[model samples]
Target: MKIKKKKRTSLLYQTNVEYGDWCLNHIENCAHGCKYPCYAMMMAKRFGRIKSYDEWINPILVENSLEILDKEIPKYKDKINFVHLCFTTDPFMYKYPEVVELTLKIIKKLNENDIKITALTKGVLPEILKNFSPENEYGVTLVSLTEHFKTNYEPYAAPFEERLKSLKHLHEAGFRTWVSIEPYPTPNIDPENKIDALLDIVSFADKIVFGRMNYNPEINNFKDARRFFEECSQKVIKFCEQNNKEHHIKFGTRYFDNKNTQTLFNKK
Candidate 1:
């Protein structure tokens, strides 16, 4: 039997996360394509196929996606509470104006049916998000503030300051904003100063998700990275408690023991 291609909206199963029930990718590739040895790229490299992530993962418009959505929504509408945009690529990439417009249109249709829409991006442009509604949640991915680290690891993403500025703009526009601090490499460095800076920018955010580096032998691993990550998590949680901010630390099986971290956070 030949498998039918899904129409306008691609069908995503689900994850344990609270954000969305369905995930859709408007594009196939990521422009930034971090050099710090991402797991996704590692798999692609081992296959000896694509030279760079952009060759395979950068944004590709799915011509049939929108029409597919119009048909699928009626059948699975009850199963979806939220629709997440572009899990594999940034929806706000500089070259995706047409894709962005179609995404906004699809989101509007979803909203009419009571499903929420959320997006996570590196935030290269603030104007791209002008149409997002208050019910839509926006997440900005941030790894480091130091320019040298950012240049080496994330050459294609916008500068740290510009991304923060985009976050601030979304917050001021009345949209729910969040931050994803994943792949925290230089974890031992004191985040007290950095946390202070982030807090100033994301004061309007409803919550934050803290994550550490994924297990990858090829990537440069700092000796004290885990210790620093925990220290930063502690500081962030304490700061959030004092200032009434909500935060969660995500520790997958590869990085740290989940039971120990859970116990540590559970203590009063």
Candidate 2:
């Protein structure tokens, strides 16, 4: 619940995560405290940005983020396909009004320049987001639907139903919407329901991004890990096709049994 501010050199930069998209992490740490070996927290430590998990759970807002964007947006506005709100931190982090204020400003700034924006969050999507350009895309990270799984893994994120409801509202409002089921847990961690059951809930999404968990040793112990993910990935593809939706199976989620690696996104 502690807030701190720090300065950064630039607010926007191209990320190579999937297909070279511009991204910005306006905050240093996340308050969600996700325990699925949070990759952001891990990277923060590896880079000596934070000393411990406790520190990582306390977010540090990027100082003058708006001013930096005001200057940087013009330089890259011509080349940017769309600026992703955040990959390392939540823009609408719960119980943090300042974070939300900054996020609104950033969205407005980019929209004023006719730049597109894409945002993914575990926190509640503010109702005002509907005021933004309809071209902007919004998404939520929803790997599980059970509160038991949420309590154990995502300690501080908004409840699963709340996130879904929020996203559904956005979708209903004619805003482009998506869901990221990235780092989805194997049965050992979730053991609740099949992937289809979960996907059924977010079927309204315009797109779905699915990926298997990584950087976790426990997953490696699951002997059926490879098979489980392959079957799950296939299910996602099938569901997306049947429902006439766009979906992306992240790199490495499916082991190409035929060793033919195609691009991740398959629009139906």
Candidate 3:
């Protein structure tokens, strides 16, 4: 893949997600080439940032990210709680040393300002990150353990075991670690997979986030999609409770019965 560079006027902004963290996307496009209807790609194309999936797989690094960040830090530092290393792109994108180097510098700069960071990636986390602030949290996205599923959907992202190894390394080193099982496929995409198995594999994480796949009509093709996600969310809550692991179930994944005035599972 050809690595390209671009300049941006600014590099930091606050995110309005429920978690309410500031976010920075130092790269445009992603090498992971996720096919779970990558929302980032969709948005990028919609905005004319890129024209096609073929172009999307070759990432464009923000050449002046560090320079831009230096200027913005002091202005937003006080108002910022923590900055997510990316909402629209992966920081530790696999096989892209340029992306990783820039991410390291970005993290160091943020830490120097006493700002924490939260990052989630499908790529392998580098070990050098262990030397950074332990307060910063690192996470990986693992929705299924099967190679068949990964090869078909995630394509260019690191293998599941490789991603898990890096996450577990960070966790065992006393750094905060988490996992995101998001845009998780239903039977239509992963027919023989089980959520519990993936959960068990990442049981070492300090927190687990579960959410259903969206956008892709194929997932909706599953007749029991609603119940499937509801039951999966309940199972995730139960597992987290029993293992003493923190958990977050994205809003739509949890179902409520207003007519009965009861919830099948307690919200976490």
Candidate 4:
């Protein structure tokens, strides 16, 4: 797809699965090339009928997106409570620094206009957090602390320890930090203990979002997935509540039921 600026359909769009106030995609493709099935992957499978992730995730720059965003912001100035950066692609992807720079420039413009911006990614760079204002939220995506699991699933992205370090750095820098435990994998051993350690690093974050693994027919043995997700959610939510930290449960058709999911989504 060609990269150019254009008016987005909605200045404020609902997050499909993950937790956040609203979402925006500053770029067209993601760089991480995550091994697990993601929203983008699912879409690619639906339309292109493409089997492999590599064939679909050719990261492209959306040059026109920023200009379109600049014009679109004013239209929903009153209703847009928070703006999420790049829902489909990781803004901090190694291949799109220039595009990410432009994206951040637009975010700064929105901030100047009194709009709040939040971002979620697995490829966060420390320098990016330095430029973010207090109103900007920074969320890091995590699933397991085991080096092997991270290497196998999120290979192209930063290491697990590096991500934790980045989260701590962002928190210390005073940016509102959050953690995303989505696409939780089913492992031979229970990872609840590992999650506690990961949460310890993110304890300073303002909030945490927990989402279950997406159900892709190609992936098998998903029977235990929902149970594990609920367990993880209960553990994290309880921990957050005990520690006086904010947390939310994200739901989708593949995992938790819609009615039960709303309990957290309805919150402010």
Candidate 5:
């Protein structure tokens, strides 16, 4: 899909999150190419914004993104509840060197204008994230610790160890750091005990956002996924509680509301 370069009247795009007000997607289509197979890619294809795997592999940098943002940020600056960076794309995607530069520029500009920003990525953590500001919140998605899961899924992204190190770096730098295990590749990455492997890095994170894998049933090994994920969520809850970490159990992964248990039986 081509980059939507046309200048917009607004860059503070509104969306839902845990008290999140607006978001910005300076780039579209992540170069990470998570083949779990990426749900974002699936949605983009469903809507005809992206039509092929080859196109998904090649990311597009939104043209005049910062210029458009400059025009829009002032309008929503007062009402902003910490704008999130690039939900449709990785704000720190390093596969495209230009995106790395753009991300840094955007963050720096927003910080200068006192517009709080939060971002999560499987990509690099540039030097700019070390700021002492209370407004900057940075996060990384460390879904699994195994190299196999990463190579098979997020092939073009940074190595798992590097990603963890970046998260730790930001956390220790006194920046508000968070982690996402969303679409937490549970039984998909480890058919044996996915939650244990998933929570191995919980201590490094200040906040954790996790949810069940959706729309990738073909790759999972859970016999009764809904029940399994509910159990997994329980484990995550316990782990986070014991460690005194803030955690969010995203929708569809909640046991109380899971509605796919018609033939549910544990085969694990």
Candidate 6:
């Protein structure tokens, strides 16, 4: 489907997502088409931000985002630490070159107005990123290293190896970098089914967040659910502590592992 473009009344706002206090999405739909199958998409569907699966895949760019932010941002500049580039959409979502260009323009405009930038994407970081201040925080969501899992889950998102390379490059170039290991999938109950993608890139992750696969029956109903998450959390916490990298366990992970599954997605 051809991508849809639209203009909006406003383009910046506050967010409850842990990474940032405020956020701005320059697009209406995400092209990633993740299969967690993306809680963001699920919420968007519920709120009527997107009407259907097909529409969500088609991406709607906020054509006047830069103009809207000019009016909205100055009013909240002092109150905002950094506006995350997106929560509902990937700033670097692959498959659509125009989305990447729009993302770069949005970031440049926000930075020109002295707004800090922070973003986590399933898309690869292009060379254009070097033009921005190294102070901007960058991140990638990596659940596993296997192509099989990614193919079955986050299919349209950047491949795991590509995400790893992106984070590594950012860290090497002196940019503050982080990784999101949330919705860390467990396709089957066996330990062999579990992955150790973290060990592959922990060295460069300036910050890390480990989380359980919330709302997935395959993992939630596993007999070793508690053991798996506990082990993973411990590993992440240990590495973060040893390397002096900032880290957090997503709020409901410990609770879910301890059999408190009800609170998993209860947070806003």
Q: How accurate is candidate 3 locally (lDDT)?
A: 0.86
Of 1 and 6, the candidate ahead on lDDT is 6
Error of 1 at 245 (Å): 1.2
Candidate 6 local lDDT, 1-268, one digit each (tens): 3567888898788876666577888887788887777787888999987788777877888888878887987788888777787888899987788888888888888788777788789989876687796668888888776667777777789887788787788888888878888877655722333445455455677888778787666775677777777778888878888889877778666634443222212112
lDDT of 5 by residue, 1-268 (tens): 2342334345667765442567888776777888877777898999999888788877777768788877887777777656778777788876666888878888888878877778888987876668634568888887777667777777888887777788788877777677788767656465443567657765777777777777776535556777777877888788889988877777678767643332111111
lDDT pick, better of 1 and 5: 5
Task: Report the poorest 10 consecutive residues by lDDT, candidate 4.
Answer: 259-268
Using lDDT as the yardstick, the better of models 1 and 4 is 4
What would the per-residue lDDT of candidate 3 be over residues 16-64, giving only the tens digit for each residue?
7644468899999999999988999999999998899999999999999
Q: Which regions of candidate 2 fall more than 4 Å away from where they truly are?
A: 257-268
Q: TM-scores of the models, in the given order? A: 0.78, 0.94, 0.94, 0.81, 0.87, 0.89
- The list of candidate 6 runs beyond 4 A from truth reads 187-197, 256-268
Model 1, position 206, has a per-residue lDDT of 66
Q: lDDT (CA) for every model shown?
A: 0.62, 0.86, 0.86, 0.67, 0.72, 0.76
Give the clash count for model 6: 0
Encode model 1's per-residue lDDT on 1-268: one tens digit a residue: 1111223445455644434357777555566576655655676567774577657545456657667777777878778767777555676664456655666776777777776777777745456565755577777778677677676677777677777677778877877677877766653332223755655556567667676666544333457555666776776677678778677677651335453332211111
Of 3 and 6, the candidate ranking higher by lDDT: 3
Kindly indicate the candidate among 5 and 6 with the higher lDDT: 6
Candidate 1 error regions (>4 Å): 1-9, 16-20, 43-51, 125-131, 187-196, 216-221, 253-268
List, residue by residue over 1-268, the lDDT tens digit for candidate 4.
2334433443446664444566777665566778776777677678874566775566656556656666777777777667777677786764456765766777777788887777777875556657756767777888777767666567777776676677778788887778887766665432433667767767777777766666544325655666666676778888999999878777551344444433322322
Angstrom error at residue 100, model 4: 2.6
Residue pairs in collision within model 6: none
